[model samples]
Target: MKRIPMEIKVLIAIFLAGVISVLWYVYDTKAKRRAEAAAPTPISQPIDP
Candidate 1:
């Protein structure tokens, strides 16, 4: 069995983290859009001075 170098391990970790973050951002945006679409619009009331 061979041991991997620290630099390669660090690079792999960074790459994986970047990929995960991108995926999370895409999913979060889609979820937010869906939630916004399902939510009802609020009616504004006239304020008397």
Candidate 2:
């Protein structure tokens, strides 16, 4: 079997990292949006004791 070139291996590693980063961004954004949506709004507090 022939050994792979170092340059090509480095390129492939960089590409995979980019894909993983994009996927994570999407996942985190969705999670944050959902959490914000499900959270309750704060009510105004009375000043009088």
Candidate 3:
């Protein structure tokens, strides 16, 4: 059996990092939307000085 090269390993790591970041962004966006839906509505009022 032959050993793998360090450059290949580095490339694999970078690819994995990119995939992870994209997944995280998607998950965070969904969570934010859900939170906004669940949040209470603000009362309507006129501002006075």
Candidate 4:
């Protein structure tokens, strides 16, 4: 088996990290939107004398 160089390994790691972060961001944004949508809106009350 051939040995991989350190530079190539570092590049691969960086690329994988970038991809994972992007996926996480997309997932988080969608979850927040879903939560917001499922939440109830507050109604304004009129002041009575």
Model 2, 1-49: lDDT tens per residue?
Answer: 9999999999999999999999999999888778767867422334467
Q: At residue 19, what lDDT does model 1 achieve? A: 100
Candidate 1: clashing pairs of residues? none
Clashes of 3: 0
The sequence of per-residue lDDT tens digits that candidate 4 reaches over residues 4-42 is 999999999999999999999999988877876786752
Per-residue lDDT of 46 in model 2: 43
Model 1, position 23, has a per-residue lDDT of 100
- Clashes within 3 Å, all models in order: 0, 0, 0, 0
Superposed by TM-score, candidate 4 places the C-alpha of residue 42 at a distance from the truth, in angstroms, of 9.1
TM-score of 2: 0.78
What digit string (tens of lDDT, one per residue) describes model 3 on residues 1-49? 8998999999999999999999999999888778767867522344469
State the weakest 10-residue window (summed lDDT) of model 2: 39-48
Give the runs in model 4 whose Cα sits over 4 Å from its true position.
41-49
- Give the whole-model CA lDDT for all candidates, comma-separated: 0.84, 0.83, 0.83, 0.84
Give all TM-scores, in the order shown: 0.77, 0.78, 0.76, 0.78
Instruction: Please identify which of the two predictions, 1 or 3, would achieve the higher TM-score against the true structure.
Output: 1
